[model samples]
Target: MKKNIAKYIEQFEQTLNFSDLSWWIIDYKNDPGYFYCNKVMANTFNLDINAQKHSVVDTCPIAGDYIKNVHLASTNKANLIIKEYLELLNQEKKEYNNTFPYYDKNIDTVKYFSSKAKALELDEEGNVSILFGLIENITSKETLSKELKEYHNIIDTNVMTATTNTKGIILNCSSALCNITGYSKEELVGQKYNILKHPDTSEKVFEKMELALAKGEIWENEIKNQKKNGEEYWIKLIVSPIFNEQGKIKAFTTINQDITDKKIIEKLSKKDKLTNLYNRAKLDILLEKELQTFERYETNSSIIMLDIDYFKSINDNYGHLIGDKVLVQIASILRSNTRITDFVGRWGGEEFLIICPNSDIENTEKVASKLKDVLEFSDFGMKKNVTASFGISSYKENDTVDTLLQRADNALYNAKENGRNTVELIP
Candidate 1:
């Protein structure tokens, strides 16, 4: 019987040496303090690896203390699993498995491991005498899982997110989305996605979005949406198509950023502070778009540049406050007189521009003449009637924004050169 036990011990040592796992055995019958610890396990705890057995008090004090005190010391949430696992290993006769953290004194770092242990031997009284254990390092996997959980938490808090089926029915929405839209998750789920769409948003925009989605392509846009309170808001939305294993579209995920305040700031930035008219920068952009339209479709368009006649003298005669009021009134007049398709902006100090789309030189000249007549008769809150000189330029085959504006500027110069309150056209 002693010889058979000796041969089993030799075979176990050979088995431990041939494998890459960390393995250990504890003996509590004949030698309570002495235990078999393979090289991997010994080196993990900075123990004497060459020795076949370790003494608990002298050779591996840290290891012994850790194993003995783990249940008492591991009261924190991060180590609760380890404590329970140790209890089961010590008390139960069956195998138990767990993942826990261990402090390695050799490298002075905490390493995670998936470990299992069982009672390997029982004494005559059926009390546990020997225990066998195996552990595998899983620090990297735990670390990655922790990082991914953190990232998910961050996105859930900050992004207005939702998932929808292919039919545009809402499946789920994040809390942030509910907060921004003033809708509860229960109200949003199982509803069509268009419930939040503002009427002012053109159907063409939705058509384009649907077209892109049908192609399994991502679509991004700034959308005007209405909240539950009927208040309007804007969102910069990105919709991505989720795919299945066969690469077919399964669902769609939307990531949205609340951009209402940004849109307000941008609108304010594009307008004149006092007059609430588009400033020169915005006018330049509008003019470029008009130019592109003309170049693409050969559509007729025109630019009308006008300024208050003797505007400096009006400022000199009355206070600048009255002059500002006069400008405001004139802006209102221009807005009321122009067609809905025309774009009006305050070009600069005392100068304004109107971009007329799909209008020829003759039609634009008629528009300038009409505006000139309207200004000549309008009251500007002053004793005298306010008048303005108008300059008109129609789009040519190869006209640039600069060249177009320059021609209108020259036409305005000609109008001012000829007389103050007249209309002039440069074809």
Candidate 2:
């Protein structure tokens, strides 16, 4: 009988050797229980063949309480497979499944484990023997899941309207983004956001966009972008970044609102109510920018200041209605003669200012002469060959806005001095 029992024990040990799981058989009824540990279990407890006679408690001091609990559960034949015990084991078999303070020589750090324990019975003597368990590492998983959920929520709930990200790569976009951009989720992924860049948008503005994104800065501004149908519209965009576990930027998110109608209203605000020419407010802004460009690039530019000749007589004799028609007709002539780059604005009542960027003194005189000739050939209802006298001044370095306007005004006096229907350059 003893020989057969030893053979059975050897066979059981051999069976455990074939698997990766760690296990051990404990004789609970015996004082200082007998332990038959598999290779994995033996390694876990740092036990050798010579240490077989020692109790499990003596060999694995950290797991002493866990073994005692399993023994107590075995006395009642309670099932304990992966059940929580006071001593918990982690996924790594090198450590006990317990939350006790212990120094790890390998990692030089303290760690904890929550383990699952099971009771196994062998023999009819009611001698509860064997405890089985498995441990899993969950610290990193718990932290990562929490952070990922937070990031997902932010991307999913963006307000405003348009889709954002460089190249339209929708890292995180809201329903509003999809609606405003006219692109489905599947269509927007990995696409350039600038695919919507409007033709009217200057290249310089796009360069700023690239610079801002590259530096990890938010870019908030109004930009003209195209729709899926190639129609242009304006949007106010606020673009920001998304960071990952190590604080590295992983993606970009943008909130945008359509502002085309607002932009139209703004443009209307800068125009003269009657003639539709830009008003003085717009002219001042244009002049200031052009002057800065001239100073920076050392470019030549000219200003033509002019007024309709004898405008009071027409309003008094022919009524304000005819005067209005004459003004509209003059505006149409000016618009037709000027290049698209020139700024033509109504400088309050009959007076007009034409800014010619990159035009020299001689070219300005020629343009002014052409303006006088064209108006002379055109006849009004009863005004009979209405004319305008122009004062031209070429921009010079260090000239302030007031100085430039004064020079142009002096040139107008010269034009009136020379002849009412003639053009003259300021001396």
Candidate 3:
């Protein structure tokens, strides 16, 4: 049988160009020392080839300890690879194929290789006598695999991820996704991903989303979804279509994050709790932007300052509850009567500020007058129609926040002196 194996080796050498590839053989008579390679590997590793036919552990200096001592310190990956290869031998498998990294001592470089091995000859009792293998370098592919692993690691840490079939059936989901959705892997797999969808999100939005995915484009948007407990949440969602080797859609991968807290904070920061109008902070921001627009482009923008007439009397007589209701009613009227380009805010208690973009002093006064009429006609629960005094000021050249506000306040004092139910303009 040994002679037959030698003849097969001779025939293989003659049939194929073996010079370019690294080849090896093993007798399996010993442990790690049983492995042996040809003169090519010997020269590559600066080892003696003649002694490889014998017990390499006894002959070559690095044979038995090569995997441990030579592989890079980070993973000791070569040792693991060799251990798995030996386990395959114990399985009575006739062929072996695996890829792993190794250290080449002669060049002092770490190289990735695919090793393919097969039984070449059998001894008596059906034990293996000779094993042959071919090793090919694959460093570039291994490097890319390593980089992709790192990229996946980063994404896994930061995002909840899931994969669904083209039919929108869930295939797999990360632990983060399961955690956020209050579902287990057992419960999620094989379920339709629409289980998380919000009813308020129209079917048309989903149609557009699916259309984009069909075209192999990534879809990104804010999505409202329901959790397992029937609680709704907002997510910054991204969906990407995964294609098979044939360039056909195989699946879609989704990554998303909870943005419910962010949306709530933004809404709270910009709105007043009592009147549902914009808050003082938001009013300041809008005013600054309007002033900036006027400075840059000479756009006519104006501010209207209005104070609820005798607000303290309303609180003292009708109570703060009625005063709050009056404020809410006023905010609703302001929102209903003003152009969409105008913004209304509760600048402070009993003081409302309005920002009107592209409005001159005349248009601003007209807006103020219209507001006065609306307030005068609107009834308070006190059985009397409530009224507000208005002061209008258009943007002037070289105006700061303080100067603009001062002019409006001075105009408001004039309105109060002139008996409170009128629009006073500062030109």
Candidate 4:
């Protein structure tokens, strides 16, 4: 309302577009008194009425020459209308309405306007004193039509985005979304948002997301989604709820950021660089978790600490490169022969640790014994068979990680004392 009343009137003109009044007022004998036009007036002429009581019209760009050149044609026509307003006042007409085309110099555009002028008060001779005017911008309707087409083009040029109904049915998806998901717009639209959800994403996770969104909160999560080719990919998903006038849920919008490479790198970080088995650090995390499980439940777990017998001699004879290959072979054998519930890790050079959850001392000994027989028999592509000595210890009641590991290390020393390729149990 402050900047240019004309522009405000034009913007809301759509609601009152069919209505007659986009109001303006003028002094019958002077400049345009009070004028209001909507966006069209701003777009066309950059026209503004001065704060003075006299009806003076000014063009923006504040420079004298640009203002004079820009508003010259429209200002002259408006002044002529003011002269006519006075004549109508003297003729005693209540109001006069008409249409005119103006050449707008700002953007070099041609605009059309429908205007109605009314006499406010009359002089002693019954002459018109002040005049009221209403203007409807007919050209702005065409301008809005052109703007909408350009807006649609701009929106589609960005990142992967999509929209859906309140019930989660897909309404539309961008081409970028189609390219990433390997689905066409035809295939994606009308489908539920879950069409791309992976089976690994549990229903509980979806329920939690739905509950958050229902309360009008934005929900963000990393989703493991399946592509059309059945290959899995990772994405950071952000969903926002669209609200209607009545404060009711209208629809939803989702933006996706592809994070497949990041997830792959994170997985590699937890693995041993040489053997690709988990490194010692990762093994410690799993071990602590197993201990926590034992603390909560009375169920037992065990650990096996082992190292290759005369591994330095093997490295010396065949070179460290061959030593690494032999270790990788040993690691492979350990991985293939162990149960899924067990964990085998490369516990530093020439050493390995096996975590056996739900296993007692007797059961742990059997596992280590099996690993020993495999190491003794498995071919290492070397002149002699490689041997590994294992020390087994099970979790005792209220035992800490340090205590359990110390007992296993002690037992491993005894296994070496008792000779290699033997499984020794801690008391």
Candidate 5:
């Protein structure tokens, strides 16, 4: 039986092709054992091929005590599988870590087995043998598993993270961060995030950013930023400090959301759909702002309320198409004639209001007369010309926006009653 076991080990050694595996068989009752090793295993410990004998303990130096424990367990009729890691010298005298599994039974210990080994079996005649098994080095698989776990962790992080230093030089960024600033990863990696700052953003915004960052307090705000194409956008930015091991702020992590579309829809809600001009709702808001400015600065301002003359007749004569065309033309004229700072909005059907800031009754009348003359000569795709009646009212120190609008409206009614295509001032 012993000779047959020795032949089996020799055949296994010749068949096994891997260079990292070693095997040994131990007699259950004795400390010394007959060991068989492959050419690879012999080369691993720089052992001579012709060496007459070798000890399992000598070959696997670090796991010597673990092997003895398995041997003791095997002699006690225990079916045991033991696994351990050992540092051993290789062919080049270099130390390498290797894993070994041992199976023990009543008669013997089988050493340097594979992780697949379960237990050892003893024949009725008392010969011990390892169950069918094979060893495969899985170091590469273990290393790859560790690396893949790390990669997944990097992908799962939520920091809208641009890798920028304190000087605002960007390095790397996460996809969430890239999506917010309207920049692609390639475009933003090396550039400053401040490139998205809008001209309308005040110094106070920067002051707040610096103050909060200096105090290590994360800052959050709904801020306006510009896109790569010079289009303005808004985002809710939350900037937090990224600290180093020294507890010093190394970088700032900023998370942002694109809110420009929402803001635009909000602004559009305040505008007239047909004329694309500010609606009455927005006019109310603007009037209050203008009135407050006038009160503070003592600025002379006036309101001009105008309505198209015979507009219903035009719509009746030439379908609503031409009526719409006339309205759009008048809107364009108002927009063109008003100063950039002046407010022009559609008050209602065929009626429009103009707020001329820093303008008195004289300038308002001049603007109104100009509008009248322009409309009187303008063609609305009809055989004849179109005109409008203008009513002007100067803002009183004690007057409200509604009161000023009402006075202009009253004058407009007086103009339509007296004559069409003329300007009238509220008494």
Candidate 6:
């Protein structure tokens, strides 16, 4: 039986020689030294690779130092390390697991190692006497993780950063994000990330983001978000997936830049300075979008084109200043009478365009008639009443922006020929 046991031990040592892991056996009952150690294990402690026995604690001071130094990232992790050490010392558990940083004499640098050990023999008195263990060098992996954490820390302090779980729950956030959003870190953490979602953002935008993230792809876009004070802000947001060792997405990190000022500038460029309404260029874009919506979704929409009656006479008689005031007043009336969803813009000269999305000709005629009545009754401080003629055109299957505007212009001419201050619809 002793011969068979020695043969088995020899086979185990040979097997461990082929592995990168450091393997060793300790005889606690007889010598308090390693009964056998493979080359990797002996080389790790700078001991004799050919030696059959060595004092475990005398030669491996690194292990003793590791147990004495308990600096860990968190209290919970420190406690677990202590528990693992106690389990190994008492030999109460079937298996022991631990990781520690130790100064390597051979390399003259601190390195990290992971260890797994189990009891291999029992003494006559039923106590554990022989222990087998393996140690693996994990310095590269641990160093990379530490470097990544440092990078994240720097970004979180200087930029708007936030991290979320797969379920969209906010896990962590930066002070910059809290400052920009007007929320406290305590209030934002553990909350769903959508608390800042603005009502004006379409659901389709969020759907697209979700689909891309689910495929572990980065998503980037300009998003309009609301603050705690109900003020709207814009952000150019980029979201990246964080992967685990298994190459599966574990979380998402978002980096954002405030773009509200940029958005404001773009909006100003699209507006008419005189009346504070969308300029003709913006009107063209709105018209095209409405037409595309109709073609794609089969949703009906209409445009109302109205021209001030004899507007050249007003500019000549009232001076261009009073004419400008009249134009501003007319723009205000259009804004007040139309739904928020309607796009009201200055078409050109004395003409204004109102694009009513999801509205048919009948509903659009009602809107035009309401505006005509309002203009006729409202006092523009001019000597005489100022009235406007209205023309309406619904979007057709093959309608383009040019075709739609041409039809509306024709309808406006018909209204002017019939008698001013009336509304007419051209199908």
lDDT against the true structure, per candidate, is: 0.83, 0.69, 0.80, 0.76, 0.70, 0.84
Taking the tens digit of each residue's C-alpha lDDT, what string does model 4 give over 185-211?
999999998999988988887798899
Runs with alpha carbons beyond 4 Å of true place in candidate 6: 1-11, 33-36, 50-52, 65-86, 140-198, 201-229, 233-262, 272-276, 279-330, 337-427
How high is the lDDT of residue 228 in model 6?
A: 99
Number of the top-ranking candidate, with TM-score as the measure:
1
Highest lDDT: give the candidate number: 6
Model 2: CA > 4 A from native: 1-158, 161-172, 178-195, 207-220, 226-233, 241-251, 257-270, 282-301, 310-341, 357-359, 375-386, 394-404, 413-419
Clashing pairs in 6: none
Q: Write down the worst ten-residue block by lDDT for model 5.
A: 82-91
Taking all chains together, each candidate's TM-score versus the true structure is: 0.67, 0.49, 0.57, 0.57, 0.57, 0.53
- Model 2 clash number: 13
lDDT, model 3: 0.80
On a 0 to 100 scale, what is the lDDT of residue 330 in model 4? 90
In candidate 1 the C-alpha lDDT for residue 310 amounts to: 88
Against the true structure, candidate 3 reaches a TM-score of 0.57
| TM-score for candidate 6 | 0.53
Q: Which residue runs does candidate 4 get wrong by more than 4 Å?
A: 1-159, 163-171, 175-221, 225-232, 238-253, 261-265
Q: Put down candidate 1 lDDT per residue, 69-89, tens digits, no spaces.
A: 455335463355546545644
Q: Which residue pairs in candidate 5 collide?
A: none
| Global CA lDDT computed for model 1 | 0.83
Candidate 6 lDDT tens digits, 186-256: 99999988998999999899899999999999999999999999999999999999999999999999998
Q: What is the Cα-based lDDT of residue 268 in candidate 6?
A: 87
